[model samples]
Structures are given as structure tokens and as C-alpha cells.
Target: MMSKNPNLTLTGPDLAALLCSRVCHDVISPVGAINNGLELLDEGGADSDAMDLIRTSALNASVRLKFARLAFGASGSVGASIDTGEAERAAKDFAVAEKKTEVIWNGPRAIVAKNRVKLLLNLFLVAYSSIPRGGTLELTLENPEFDAKFKIVARGKLMRVPAKFVEITSGQVEEAIDAHSIQPYYTVLLAEECGMELGHSATGEEIIFTAESVSV
Candidate 1:
């Protein structure tokens, strides 16, 4: 069922809930691994190999938690500012699971807005969909203004933007699907919320999405 309070904007509590949900979802697996490893350690015949597994799982879980906080948590909580190297590290760390997509970062370290952080994560999801076989994802931030511009380029074999996804991005459609399509929807939502324009297109195995800040 849909929410009755349709006009309700996302409140601080709402955002907090969303962030908590995201954190829980991401940490579940590694937490489970750590638990299993601890159980193994408790076993009477535990060996060095078991201890190594425990250590590795704990480290992996720690990294995941730190990265998730940086990506999804509040900007101030992350740090005073995030450098390009830090951004690149965060992107690569977040993009590790899929293995098919390589995230490349460009541009100087600017204080990334919280909304942009969320948009970038969604953009990564969209890029993953474009390159089913695997490819390189390039993200560039430029022209920071009331309506700043962020460019995302996904290039690889068989990179084709789905027409329906394009329609949603262009404000021609309004329906939600899973993450595969939801990313584009949220892209449009974020643009509209920020008084920005979202442009998307595909050309010769390259799909590009750009968000331009709109003039008041």
C-alpha cells in the first residue's frame, strides 16, 4: 500500500532510518561470516587456518562498515572534506563486489554534497546495469553552481541504455521497479528536488547521464 501522507518530505528521521537500513543490509553478510568464524574458533580442533579466516573476516567487516559510513552517512561525519584519492578509494571499495565494472574518478576534491553522494551511488548502480559483460565507469564533477553538472559515462561491450529507463530519467514516465530501473527514477527525483536537469543518452556502446543544476 502506498503511504497516506504523500506530500511528506524526507525528514531527518526518515533519512536516518534509510541510512540504518542500508547499513544493516550491507553488514549482514560480513557479520554472518564473522559469527561463523568465531564459532569455528570455539571448536576444539581450531587451527591457524581458522584463526586466519576469523581475522580476515573481521577485517573485511570493518572495511565494509567504514566505507558504508563514508558513502551513506552524513558528510560532516565522513570528514571536513574528501580528496580525490579518498573518493577513488571509496568508489573502488564500494564497487568491489560486481567485479565487472571499474570505477574511475576525475576532478579535484570538492566538498561533495550529501544529495550528490546518494546520486553517485545510484549512478554506480545504473552503470553496472549498462555493462552486463563488464566495463569501465567514469564519473566527473564540474561547474559547481546553483545547478552543478555531474557526468557519468559507462562504456563497454554491449552498453545500451534501456528506452524505458531513459523515459523515466527524462520525466516522461513515472513508475518504480527494482534497483535496475529505480536508480534512474531516483536520478530524476534528485534532479527535480535540487532544481536540476537530468540528461541521458546512449551512443555506440557508451551510455551517458548528466545532471545539470537548473536556474531558479
Candidate 2:
């Protein structure tokens, strides 16, 4: 565990760079596998296995890239609404990446403000990462219109919650926003921007995240 920095504030470019680095970290494995598969094909081995490897790696890379886009990218126009169905699809695809996590998204297909949806997806990132050994994520929504609120229930074996997670997410620690700690801070930022407040709690086997709209 790294020591907390109370004065942590990241410049726009620095934050962008770290986020790009995180996305690269995710896609690198599958992209590297694809390259390896291609190199094997070039070495005069035209086995079905090589082709299968390439196909699978390509799909994995694609799925991860899509997830990153919605999770971190500027998804749509300013003040535009994103289809809840799209967010659900992204979450489901991301969970299936390891075949170890199951996602039960009860969020309907209502259109939501882009920032709200981004907040939801980013919360998913934080929740999913807490369960290192993989688990189940159930997303339930409330008042999906203007006063949108949601809860994420994460369950798994041996769940790990850093004491600093809540601190960072609530903007308590401002001095440390590295690759490892950026997502939670980012989630907090989004919530604040969207007039929402976040809460988190954990037990031995379950972690719950709740975000509710508040008067700003």
C-alpha cells in the first residue's frame, strides 16, 4: 500500500497520459497474443490453432478496447444522453473477458446523461477490480430519469478493500493519482460533476457501492 498524498492533484495532460497507459496495459496482452499468433503463421506453420489464436486475441482486444472507450473516453457530445443498453452491453462484455465474473445488470435501457453513464461504468471498474479472484456484480438502478441513482453489489471470495479506496473516491486523498489509484478518484470526480454522492462498504465476501443524486 502506498502512502496517501493529501495534496494530490493531476494536471489534465498527466491524467490523460495515465489513463492512456491504463488502457494500453489492458489491450497489450491480447494485442501481443495476436502478434505472436501472426508471427507463428509467418513461420510456415499454418495450423488451425494459429488461426484460432489470432481470432480469439483479436476479439479480446476489440472487447477490451470498447470497454475502455465507454469507461474512459469522451463517449458522446456534451450533455448528450447515452443509451443504458450500451452501458449494459459494455459491462457484460467486460465481465466475460475472464469467464470468472457474472454481471447481472438490472439497469434498463433508459437514456441517461453521458456523465451519469460514465460514472456508472467507472464505478463498475472500481467494483470489479476489488474482487481480485473474480465474482458477481449486480447493478440496480433507481429513478433513471433526472434524479438517477444506482447501486452496485459485488460478491466474491476473498474480497480485498484497501482502506484508502473510500478516501480516494471521496476526494480525501489528493496527492496520489497514479495508474493504480486513478480510477477511484476519477469515479469521485464524475460523481461530483454529476451532482451525485457515492458510498462504499465491504464485508468479508461482499462489497457494495451506492451512488445517489444530490442537490448540488
Candidate 3:
């Protein structure tokens, strides 16, 4: 939906605000359910049901927070690298939070640059979006230390790539950036900043996202 635009402009504060809103949007539902469960218990409704809701909602909140931390937070100082094992846990947890996607992580347990991990998480989110009817998210990193390439396959009963999502990821957006598009936008930004080539395509029921490091 979008072509490469090196000047996809967004102010630093605005991007931060939108991404914050996006993270809040993701956690609000589960957090609200937690509050609802508590109120139900206060009303003396079926304690079993209330407790179940509270427990599940709490776990969901925890999972989402973990994913957000890796996907959006500054994990460390400059030049920091994250362990691939940790990235795998975040990816797997995010899929669980969605309740319909399964994550297959084949990346090594070695350390990878922070930007690389962030881009990986964002691509996982993109693939998750494509599979609306529950699916498998197969993510891989080949040769992490040198000639690194990341691949994510999204396969499902029903799959779609939003025109806007494609536009943002491909760096072709001329419109104002909003929370809906910020995730992909950030993914592309990270790829560009890290000298990683970003691309995506769909085949039959599968949507594939890839990023490859480019030599200087």
C-alpha cells in the first residue's frame, strides 16, 4: 500500500505519545476486566467465575506488559543487545495474549542488537495482525552474528494485510501517523536505522515479513 519514503516525518514527542497510547490501548482491556472481576466479587456473584476472570485477566495483563516492554521500551543504554532467548519469550507471550496465535521461534539464544530485537517484535505484531482468524507465527533468524536475516510467516484460516499497514511498513506513508499505524512505522524505522532491509508479501493464506541486515 505504500512505497519507500525516506522522509516519513513524525516528531519525537508525537511518536512517543502515540506509541504510549498504543501500549495503553493494548493493556486497558485486560486491566478493565481485572477491575470488573473485583466488582463482581464485591457484589457476591459466583466467586468461582469472578476469581477465574481475575486470574485470567491478571495473567493477560502480565503477558501484555512483558511484550510491550521488549517491543517498545528502551531495554538498555546505547549499543545494548538483547538475548534472543528473551526475545523468544516475549514473542511467545504476545501470541498467548492474542489467544489465537502460536509462535514458533527458531532464532538462536545468542545476543542480538536491541534494534534488531525490537524490529523482530514489531514484525511479529504485524504478522499477528494479518492472521485475524487464529494462526501460526513462525519467526526465524538465520546467522544472527553475520549476514543476519529475520523471517516471519503468518498463516491462518483467514489472513489479511491492511493497506495502511503495508504502506507504513514500506515507508510510503504521506498521511499523519496515528496509533493504528505507529507499530509498523516504528518497525520500518528500526529496520532503516539498523541498516536492515524490510519487506513483506502474501502467498495464498500466508503472509511473510522479512528483514535482512545490509553490509556497510
Candidate 4:
């Protein structure tokens, strides 16, 4: 899954396109399953158990699609702001949807640029990856103003950070970036584009992220 990085440099448009493709790739299988379930219902008549299973599967797929749309895809106009309430719901749903991590958001309701929400969601995934079995991720905001500082704390029994992901975020391993490591790399790029600075630290049982406005 090599990214189209011309001149060995990933551009904004390249990352955007890659993320869009990634989300689509993830949602396609579940969506296709839902479609298949629908076809089965049409042909098989009223089967209660089968209908119940299909309903649950459809709901799961819908939740995932919504989460992917908010987290990876563009939510609105280029410079438009998104409601933090909506972002919070999407993040919580996404975290629970995976059934691997539980998220606790501690912040006030405030509007921020959609890019910041995108960065936040990407950071969530990074933290989620640290936990092998299951874990708790706590996202906190130091300030809920237009230009705010946020922190992400993830804790689990086994926490492992991938070197490639760290390197990509630091812009240290540009040539090694592929579809798997692109999210972390793109998170860093998007943060900088939105005038923010991002840093991460990891311990044996935890990984912490700190992001603040560069304008500060």
C-alpha cells in the first residue's frame, strides 16, 4: 500500500486522498455485508432471528460509516468549524464501536476548526493502537476556546508504540510511510497546517499526547 508521494514527499492532497481511500476501504466490507443481509431478507421471507442479526449488523455498519465520515473524511467546508458536541459523539461511538477501547471525554462544549477534530480523531486511533487487549482513553481539554490545548491519555495492561508510527509523526522516516503508517504522519501534517504543535510520550502502561496551538 505505497502512498503516492511524488519526490518522496507527501503532499496535503495526497494525504487527503489516501485517507479518503482508507476510510472507504474500511467501510466497504461492512456495507457490503449489510447489503447481502438485505438481499437475504428479501429472498428468505420473515425470519425473526435472521432479521434481528441483520438489524444489529446494519446498525454497527452505520455507526462505523458515520464515525469514518466524521473522523477521516471532510466534515464541511475547508475552513469551517465543527461543533465539539458532534465531534464528541463521533469519537465516543468510534471508540466503543471497535470494542477494544473505551473513551472518556472531559471538556466543555465549544466549536473548533474541523481540522482540529480530525487531528483529535487521528490521535484517538494512535492511542487505541497502544493497547493490545483493551484499555481506557481519556481525552481532556486544557481550554475550550477557539485556540485550545488538548491532551490524550491512554492506559492499558500492555502498551506498545510502533517505531515507524513515531518516526513518521516526527518526519524522521518519510520513505518508510505506507498506508498503515500514513494516519500518524497525516495527523502531524494536519496539526501543523492548522497552526498546532503535537508531541507524544509513552510509558510502560500509557501513552500521552499533548497538542497546543502554535500561535500560543
Best by TM-score: 3
Q: 1-216 in candidate 2: lDDT tens per residue?
A: 221333346678998898888889899999999999989999978778889999888988998999888889988777888888889999899888667899998856798888888899998888888788898999998887778888999998878765456777644764566777777767777877778888888887689998999975
Error of 2 at 122 (Å): 0.6
Off by over 4 Å in 4: 1-8, 35-49, 174-176
* TM per candidate: 0.66, 0.89, 0.94, 0.83
How far is 10's C-alpha from truth in model 4 (Å)?
1.7
Supply candidate 3's per-residue lDDT for 143.
87
lDDT of 4 by residue, 55-83 (tens): 76677678878877777777887788878
lDDT of 1 at 100: 63
- Local distance difference test, per candidate? 0.63, 0.82, 0.84, 0.75
Tens-digit lDDT track for model 3 on 1-216?
Answer: 232455457778988999999999999999999999999999989999999999999999999999889889998898899998888998887778668889998857788888888888888888788888888989989988667899998899878886776777655677878988888888877887778888888889688889998887
Which ten contiguous residues of candidate 4 have the minimum total lDDT? 1-10
Q: Per TM-score, what order, best first?
A: 3, 2, 4, 1
**TM-score: the better of candidates 1 and 4:** 4
Q: Candidate 1: worst 10 consecutive residues by lDDT?
A: 1-10
The CA root-mean-square deviation of candidate 1, after full C-alpha superposition on the true structure, stands at 5.3
> What lDDT score goes with residue 156 in model 2?
89
Per-candidate total of colliding backbone pairs: 1, 2, 1, 0
Q: Tell me how far the alpha carbon of residue 135 in candidate 1 is from the true structure, in angstroms, after superposition.
A: 2.7
